[model samples]
Target: MGASFEQRPQPWVTNISIDDIHSRDFLAISKIHGRWGGFETLEKWVCGAYAGYTAVCLRDSEGKLWVGESRHDNEQGAGATEVQYSNGDNAIFVLFLSLRGEDVIAVLPWDEWWEFELNKDDSNPHIALLPLHPDMRAKFNETAAWKYAQSMNGKPYGYHNMLFSWIGTINANYPPLLDAHVVASVMTVCNQMQPAYAANMWNEALNKRLGTEVPSYSICNCLAWDLPDLIVKTEMRGSSFAELLTIPEQDDWVYSDGRSASCVAFVLEIYKAARLFDPISRSIQVTEFTIKDAYSLRFFENNSSRLPKWCNDGDDVEFLFCQIRGRYRMELPGYNTMDPYPHMNEMCPSLPPKYSRPSNCLKAFPMM
Candidate 1:
């Protein structure tokens, strides 16, 4: 029994103002159907479907990267400010948010995010905000588009939800309706950028290119190749492989079938059912689904009868084969959650860790 997307909660909409970092040092590196952090790892697999940069571009034991922009009062001894990019040898400290194209870059000043109210507005401020829809952009800021953002006079960055679809900090009390108008306007460059094409098309494209079974997010990336090519890669939470591994509509990871460790069988089914091509890399990046839950993988027919009794009965054996298949397929990393403003509190870490440190590793960790 499948319910419709409408049955789900209504999608939250907000207003935002994004500015571009037109500098020579950093090029906007957008991944159209590619892996996260410029690498593939087990954690990348568990944390799949990254539609944002935070989940994809990691520190890799790195303390920080250089923010490009500099504040007027930036002193030499000032701490490493996470900015869009560092200004001149003049020593104006800035930070880099994520690396895009060969030279293009995206950045946010260190203080803007921390200075805002109760949300990511105060946390990761470097998120380049954008007006949510074409309609909102016209009514609020005139066709000026980010004029207010580009001309901020050292004030707390404020966003009207009507103008942008992004919610950084919300009004403690619902704000008053400022005003509105209708304009029969033609669309502009900022107007059209979306992951077009059906999911099936995404699947077909990746499967054809990689010569292997293309995951759902991969399908999205393949579609992205034609659409907006500037967005950071997605987060793993965008699509939950665990959600798929878990039975339909049930939060519980346990399967009703007699036994659950069916990793090898499922992997084989994936190979048979999916369109896989690259034998060398054998890569496929999945979401926040970890190897810890890897054991829960199950199949109806007997596939691992030759395995020992305990491993077979318990839902852990499937992980062993999944590890092999992961290496075999060369699965790449993907993104998880996309809410520029991530709410960690509401979201308790719900899924089990099938592999080592689902937050970090892409390939399953060696069974300790």
Candidate 2:
């Protein structure tokens, strides 16, 4: 299966390292929730979003389990996140690859995913919501957990419920299959932020009815509103921004006409401090932008920033090297600028007037 994507398997193939998936008592899961086996629908969420293989599990000849991941590299738990070979005798680096004909059963451990770091600032702070397994069982199966599994092996691509069932299965699965726990966590990561949010809103409403901020109970303790209820920004599936762009037939009817549409993001900058409630408080934000109020649109960069795999090594620049297509252009604002200012470069977008500038656009936008 690994051979197909690259025309051949490299296992003949670089034997850089070896990891035994079975012998480890505990396999730390990196992304209790992530896509596995290259499902097309999951492509945009992780791959382009900068989420690579979440965790790599390997067993050593010493009968020990070692795990590592590409989710986030440095400054996490011990403030040290990547796995480096400390001793060659008990180390292995496993790379997750997409191989043709591999029905890879992606196991998501939802519970642990809740434990993922909660960060919001860097363009892709969602990484905090991902999970990683601990070297210790912390607590064994004693009403604490069980080894459960869910399979979409033969289900339709968008059965939808298959994903939910997968989450429940992960929660039900315990330590016997530490891998199962990791799988369950991965499934948890897969759960859209919906159920968590819906459950919270009502629970909070109930709490408010009681007239107190105390005594709060969360059906899903993993839900984090601070992360932003982004799903509400637009529809969950299909062409990225078609839902945002299309109105009911009474409005535009273009989407109803059935022609596939893609998103053209106009990434302007907004300067503010990064705070939990407002994302603007202590720090002076330099990058800000103002969008002209036409186009009935907002900007999200037709493309995502290409983050460097090694954060400290710093190869990829995460600015307006952005993605764009079809009539979008970038420009510097001027007093009484034309309705559609001329685009300065292929990467720059011409101003649209659908959106009124949100203040401090110059500080928010990167200067071309």
Q: Note the clash tally of each candidate.
A: 89, 60
lDDT of each: 0.20, 0.21
Residue-by-residue lDDT tens digits, candidate 2, 1-368 = 01111121111112111221221121111122324324322322211112212222233234444332222222222311122222334434222222223222222222222234322212221121111112112221211111100111111121211111111111221223333335324434544456554333222222222222232354554533221232222223331211111111110111111111111000011001001112222222111111111111111112232312221122122332211110112121232222222211112112112212222222121111
RMSD of each: 24.4, 21.3
Which one wins on lDDT?
A: 2
- Candidate 1, residue 5: lDDT: 18
lDDT digits (tens) for residues 1-368 of candidate 1: 11111211111111211121111111111122234233322222322211122210111012232122211222222333242212233323222222222112122332342232114221211121111122211222211211211222121111111111111112211123311111001111323432232222122222222223333445354332221121111112242211111111111112111111121112211221222212311232211122212212121112344322322122222411111100011121221112111111111122213211123222221111
Q: What shift in Å separates residue 38 of candidate 1 from its native position after superposition?
A: 25
What's the lDDT for residue 124 in model 2?
A: 20
What would the TM-score be for candidate 2 when compared with the true structure?
A: 0.19
